[model samples]
Target: MQKGKIGVSSDNLFPIIKKFLYSDHEIFLREIVSNAVDATQKLKTLASVGEYKGELGDLTIRVSIDKKKKTLTVSDAGVGMTSEEIDKYINQIAFSGANEFVEKYKNDAQAIIGHFGLGFYSSFMVSKKVEVITRSYKDEAEGVKWECDGSPEFELTNVKKERRGTDIIMYIDDDNKEFLEDYRVEELLKKYCKFLPVEIAFGKKKEWKEDKQVDTDEDNIINDTKPAWTKAPADLKDEDYLKFYKQLYPMADDPLFNIHLNVDYPFNLTGILYFPKLKKNIEVQKNKIQLYSNQVFVTDSVEGVVPEFLTLLHGVIDSPDIPLNVSRSYLQSDSNVKKISSHITKKVADRLNEIFKNDRKQFEEKWDDLKIFIEYGMITEEKFYERAEKFVLLKNTEGKYFTLEEYKNIIKDNQTDKDKQLVYLYATDVDAQFTFIEAAKNKGYDVLQMDGQLDSHFINHLESKLKDSRFVRVDGDVVEKLIPKDEKQEMKLSEGDRLDLTPVFHGQLPQRGKANFLVTFEAMSENDSPVLITQNEFMRRMKDMAEMQGGMSFYGDMPDNYNLVINANHPLVMRINEDKEKDLEKDLKGMKSKISTLDKRRAELEKAKEGKKDEEVPSAEKEELHDVSNKLDELKKKKETLLNEYGQKNKLVKQLIDLALLSNNMLKGEDLNKFVKRSIELI
Candidate 1:
């Protein structure tokens, strides 16, 4: 028998191991099972190198729970430890007094025991006492037993055992009695060891015989010794990858495609990344990609390992180089992690490029489902953007797909303005912007559907990337100004005529939710609608962006700015302007002539005061100017009121405004009903 305090540099090592070394106490099962697998792997490696010349017997790691005894046992027929090895490896935790180790990680408890190659100590987390019965795989080796009762002291002694293996028995603490449950242990095994390279068995296979279930002689193996990712890519088919994806996500829809990542040089990394059929919501699809270390499941939250934008992908990423237990910050800054991230990005880009080049029809068919990923990548990662631009597709409103370069080539000759800037017109809603889209189509221009959830931010990113190019919403402005195909048409109406006729349409503008309408006139073809509404691109994009990202909520709070543009050359608009002048000219004439005289006097006073200081200007002249300004403002208001009354009486004014609103799908409820009733009578 051997009795001695476990050789530890710190007296509080046990407390630190049990309380601070693991973030989740339940992960102790993962650590212990992982260690068993590691041992099994080591034995396999030795046999491959011809170091061990004995029969390579069954190597299944077994996990059993004894309910009555309140103990959980994990046994492995692998490279078992001798007494000397137990003393040297298991007892010694650190070379230093380890005060620095304690001090450095005293406050932070996220550090896992497995991180320091001390995974066995994690068993102490849930155990009141742990027993290890191990015998080395040697001809004359004797079995040995080591026992510890959640303290620095441990007892080791030789024991009789016929088998060459190790068995770890953990006496569950009173507070952790749940570990003794068969269901609990099975769940932990499936979570942590589901895809381990070595076989893992829990309990025994059962058969429904007689009236109920009965245990069979066959072992109930729980793990897939060879998951699909561990195999060579050439050995896997499309169906195999899809089947694995389904295995990972039983309830999810089939993935669009997958990229098999297998790289050994510089760092060992192997896994399958599936491009899931993402929905409009980006957050719901995150955390689907699980990270593994040498087939041991580490974390599904792989934000720091994979790029943040790539977390939407589903499946597994196993890399032996990545540390099993690491702080997110540490993982983000680690050089190996950075290399792995870049490699993954390159692999993804290459895969996408291959698909796009080989099967363009398939790529186009899947473009809608695939664009969100490409767009998000382009928006977040610069290198991804550089690579993705080669295969990135732009979908048009007519349901056609074109690569960025292809679309640019098609539109550069037609959509480029005199300023030499290529205009990429897009629409959010095809049905709502149907008129604008048709107008653009008629002008030999194309419109894209930028309806994805990420499109707002992606549009901003593309504008910055594409040289001398801009993205305009199809309804962002009048068609003439949107592309400026020809020299801008001169406004047919004078400024005074436009100002005098503005109140006619302004008075009839219907109230919509948080909508601000500015009545303006522009010259257009006589065939064009007399009135149409268009939103400013910059203001609308700011509001749309505010909805996607949270920082610019003030833009969201602001009213939507719509320009109620009147086609001055159209017959209806011309008639309306002429009628407004004919009806209100006599009434406003007297007030206008008096206002003109007052304005001229006020202008003379403003010019007189321009070069002079405020105090130097005569007080009598200031009073005359102030009086003239007040009278002119009063006269203008009265003239505007008369014109407003005329417009309210003219049903044509209300009908024109409603027609423009209806064309834009903004007319609703009672206003639509009145427009319908008035349209019948006017017809």
Candidate 2:
């Protein structure tokens, strides 16, 4: 027997490894199994290189849990370490400063992950004592047994003859006795070794015999050894990718399509990214992109390695260049990782462009599923947008799909207004905004379907990118004003008449929550819609953006203001004016007399104080002016009250307002029911 202290500068090594080396206690199993795999792979390499002249026997790595013994053993058939190698690799902790090492690599679960040659030490996290029985492949090497009891000290001695391999045995501690359970060990193996290249044997396979299930003699292998991503794309069919998707996410919906990535020169990267059938809630589908290093599972949260927009995709990204650590800091600084990200972006854009050019019908078939992803990429990645601009599609209300340039060319002649601004008409809902859509269509113009999860943000981005282009929702304005085919028509109604009608309509506006209405009269042609509801584009966009993002919540809390545009050229609007003139002519005459007298007195008082400072002006003149202003305010109130009374008694006013509200889909619940009943009663 030989004895010596561990090769380390400090005696507090065990405490450091126990408390801070790994982020999760669950990772102990992955480390040990990874070490066993490394050993098995090394033996295979040695045998292939003529270093060993022995039978390349079974290369399986076995995991066994002994309940009564409270021990979990990971045994591998590979190049095991001899006594001297054990002393150097196991006994010697080749670390400079434990604190600095832990701090530098703490965030990265992969940095200290398979490093430290201390894959064996991770056992100390869950074990009270760990024993290693290893036999080197060398002809004259003696089998050795090394044991440690969660301390710096260790015992080494000769052991009985065994195969040329190593068996790591761990005695589960009181706090971690759960590792001794069969199901727990099985779950850990499935999590960390499900796609490992080597064969991992957890336990004997079972079969359902006549009366009950029976354990068979066959060893239960937990991993695939060769996942679909590692194979050639030519060998995989569409169903194969779907099958692999089901294997990765059994409960998820079938993916729309997949992009097989196999690049070597710039940076070695191979994986299958699936365009998941992303439902409405985009937040729940994140973190599904698993990151791996040489088939060893690293993490699923690959925010730093992948471009921000690409995070919306679901699949696996396996690269040796990416760091293997809980903290992904290593990848954040790796030049290779940056190149890999750029390559991935290029590949995704290339695939989309190819799909758009080759099978546009299929692309259109899946546009709803693909729109959000394309929009996100365009909004976030500048380079991606450059490539995507050619293939990004727009489906108009006519159900025809056109690329950005295609749609621009088709509409350039007709959609460009007198100011040379290219107007892009769009509708959030084709059915709800059907009236507006039809109006725009009737003008020989196209209206796009902008109903999407990210369309609001996408339109904002598009407007910024496309020069002289403006995205106008179909319902944003009246048909003529939407494209501004000719200069805006002047309002024919007199200013006094507008003021008189404004109060009448304003008093009858809806009393819904935070719902304010602005009454505007447009001299649209008689053929145009009698009434239109237009929301301010800026305020509406702010609220839509606020729903998706934070810090703009003030806009979300503000009232929803809409324009109650009454077409003055329409017959109903003209009749409303005629009725108002006949009903309020007498009241208007009396109010005008009172208001004119007050205004004359106020003008005389103001003239007395003109060109004079407050100290120079007489208090009597100021008091007289104030009295006149009060009388004017009283007369205005009387006029407003009379207008409200006229509006209340007029059915044309209520009928027109309700019809406009119904057209905009703003009348809901009780209001909608009342509108239906009112329509019946009027008919």
Candidate 3:
């Protein structure tokens, strides 16, 4: 036996490894297993080059846990390290000092490890002591035993003969004895090594012998050596990709479609990206796409490697070029990673385009499920937007799908406003906006369903991208005003009469938040709803955006403002106007005369005091002006109360307010119940 100190400038190497180098202690299994896979791959490369003459039989790596012995072992039959090789690779710690190393990589622990090749050292994180028993493939080499506690000292000695492979035995520390359990080790292996290139065995296969599970001699492999992504597209059927997806996410609904990513020119990247059926609020399940380095699992939090939008996809992405690191930003900014990202985006867009061109009906069938991803891509990636324009689908409330050009063509003649801007009408809720949708359909217009989580931001993006086009919510205005033709009708009511009618209708409406409603009149076809509640497109869109995104939180904090648009052509509004003209015309005129006199007196007092100091202004004149203003305001109130009384007796005013409230799906709780009862009585 021989003993030597580890080649390190500082004795603090083991402490750093245990506390700071790796993010999680459980990753030790992944690191050891990854090292085993690398050794196996190296042997395969040598055999391919005709350097190894031995049989390459059963290249699976085996993991076994001995609970009684408190030992966890990872054994691999591959190219093993000889004594000299072990001295160079394992004994030497590569860093100047712990502080300097940490300062250089404080923000990104993974970058330091990935760049400097620290895979083997991670084993020390979980083990109190570790032993490597191995025999090199060289003919004259004997098996060697290397032992090291969590320190800078290690031992190397000759051992009994063994196969040309390595077995890493980790004596689980007292604090981390959970690793000695078979289930714990098995779970870690499955999570990190499920899609590795080499088969990984956890234990012997179990069979239901005599109605009880009993372990067999055959190895129970945990990984698929040849996942669907590794196979050629020509060789893979659609069902095969879906089967693999189901294996990855057993509880999820079937994926809409998949993009097989295989590129070599710019950067080596191979993976299958599945478009999941994303409906309603888009909950970002981070780390859904596993990033692998040469088929060994590195991480699932591949935010930097994959485009932010493509993170919604689920599958495996194996690339030797994408270095595994905790700081995804560093990985993303790497030249090879950037190239790979661009290539993946192009490949995704191309796949969608191909599907649309070849089998449009099928593509349309999956559009609802695929819209969220496509819209997110277009919203985030400029190049992706450029390519996806042709294939991105617009789904209408009629359960039909169309490309941008197709939908624009369908609605151009009927829905274009007087300014020649093409109006693309949309509805967020089919049930809630049913009235608006029916109103649009009544005018021979189509309403697309822009209801996805990203649709708010996406519509804004499309408005900027599409020329002379605007997306208007179906409830944005009365159908006639929504796509305004070239005509304006004059309001026939006097100013006094308009003032009288304002409070009558405003008094009956329910108040919510700081809601402000402007009572306006529009001449429309009598068949349209007598009252329509509409919001400005910009404000509504901003508010919708605020619901999904931050930075515009000010818009979200504001109350919803609506227009209580009363149709003048409808009989109910016409009768209300006629009643106002009859009941309050004289009183409103008298009040207006008094108000004008009071305003003149008050203006003169203010005008007289313009250049004068407070002492110079007469108190009598100020008191007289205040008295006049108070009398004038009282007279105006009397006039308003008379009109409000008249309106209260008129059920048409209450009916209109209720109708508008009901249309917005805002009349709820007891108010909704009252509205339903009132509606039945009115009908």
Candidate 4:
């Protein structure tokens, strides 16, 4: 195979570099400011190494805007370039002097991010013309002036400069004159350079004077040179972290906890992540984690950099190991990124574990706020789930918290089902599900309050991870069926009696749009409420997940189905049965006999014609069978009408159904008003 060198044409190079060097035009400001930081850091490195024997004056980098001229300038008090140095580095594209300087002074120049060489060209992304005035730190080396427009042409000349630093001035292009506005430039500086190592000054500090704001001589320093994350853990106090958290999120509720990550062995990473008081909207909490490199703010969107669950946290992470330019594919494949992500997950888990072990009470106090983050982590990351299981807490309606294992031990003997699966009963809302919660509590079973936004998904995740343990909402079933240690209680009514009594309770159900009710009879203890409403666990779970996640609209779109369970053994229910028998006993017996006769004949005819095809069956037999089926339907309808008429006059039936519906927070409007009036009349 023949090989040849890839060539880049001079004519296309300038435009390509300006248009595609960075993603956004606003990034030009970040690039120029970062280059200034690199130069300032280089000067500090020289002074430390004894190569530059000169007093290092104030190393502040200043950003200023000239709106009238539509120009932007960044000035730094750091190592400047000589005429030849400018020719070698500036004239050549993608050759940063900071790289060479950092390599030579690698031990002392830890702060140098090594971006100035090529990043300088990024200024052209938003500028029609650019000028560089720089003076060498070496004595008697002449100052140099370099200027370039949007083309591949440049001018260099000798220039008088007093400062031993660089000043990059850009004539803002018409399309990007927004950069010339003082507020816009200041906003960019704060976004990208707020945590930089060197002080960055944007404008004069403003003070309130005579009810108006006026500029003062004091510089408006835009960044905190020594941010909390850059310092050693021993040097920081709790208050220091709190102050940093406030700086990051001014209006957020105080965080539940903070994880200060400082790692250097596998990869350089430093950050302070705070677990904020998360709301129901997970989307709103994301993109709060900021990513940085050597204190230069890179981006607030850190999804690819951190574990997905950790993005829910609010904080800053700075690592030179994580490349300045991060893309999804690059981050997913990069070894350094993988290491950093793993390390951060471990740090978060470790911090949570430490707090739990040292201060149990405090951990419980913050459980509500910390729960969503922990649950989200446990759901998304296997390693995180493994670690979190040790500290993740379960809170009950009694307001007590326990670890998964502890909760299992506390409820095992009472909650283990006939299938030997442990049951974890929970409620979404303490007030809304109060009756069910109390029902479980009355039976000496603990009811967990899983009310957080992600708790629905978290419950599903826990079921998969825990050993044969299932989480059932308190309202998922009656107490006996929820755990099911014993076989289901047989309904007290007979097969015929059950069918005859269905209409008694079913007929009184109020019309609820998109809601379906199935009348069920359960032989519960007389002490229990006569009627109770319960939703099936699996169907409810699908609907809950559909609301939180995508691709499950089938379940969400299905009409709500609830079991209106009639406690057959309850005194009031037995009394309703007695009253129904008194009113419809003669009519029910006559209907039952006729129904049996028709059903028996229908079954006989169906069996006789089973082997015979439809065409072989005689027309007389088909007509006789059809008449029997019609008679069955007519007899059933008459029986139902008789039971319904009896139920209409029975206030107890209405009150019991109303009580069950009200307990579920489902009774409303005219039905509720009628229930109150009927209850008063009965009293």
Q: What lDDT is reached at residue 292 by model 4?
A: 82
lDDT of 2 by residue, 16-87 (tens): 777766567777888788888878888788888999889978999999988889899999888888898898
Candidate 4 stretches with Cα past 4 Å from truth are 1-8, 94-115, 208-214, 326-333, 487-491, 596-630
Which is the better candidate, 1 or 2, if ranked by lDDT?
A: 1
- Lowest lDDT 10-mer window, candidate 3? 323-332
Candidate 2's C-alpha runs over 4 A off are 100-116, 325-332, 488-492, 590-632
lDDT of 4 by residue, 428-534 (tens): 98988999888898888999988888988898888887888899999998877888876566666676667767888877876788989999988888888899999
lDDT of 3 by residue, 360-382 (tens): 99998888778878888899999
Candidate 3 whole-model C-alpha lDDT, 0 to 1: 0.82
Candidate 2 lDDT (Cα, whole model)?
0.83
Q: For residues 152-187, what per-residue lDDT tens digits would candidate 1 score against the true structure? A: 898999999888888999999988888888888888
Off by over 4 Å in 3: 98-118, 209-211, 325-332, 490-496, 580-633, 676-683
- As a TM-score, model 4 comes out at 0.91
Lowest lDDT sum, 10 consecutive residues, model 4, at 1-10
Q: What local lDDT score does residue 401 receive in model 4, on the 0 to 100 scale?
A: 86
Colliding residue pairs in candidate 3: none
Model 2, poorest ten-residue lDDT window? 323-332
Better of 3 and 4 by TM-score: 4
Cα lDDT of all candidates, in order?
0.84, 0.83, 0.82, 0.82
Residue 424 error, candidate 3, Å: 2.7
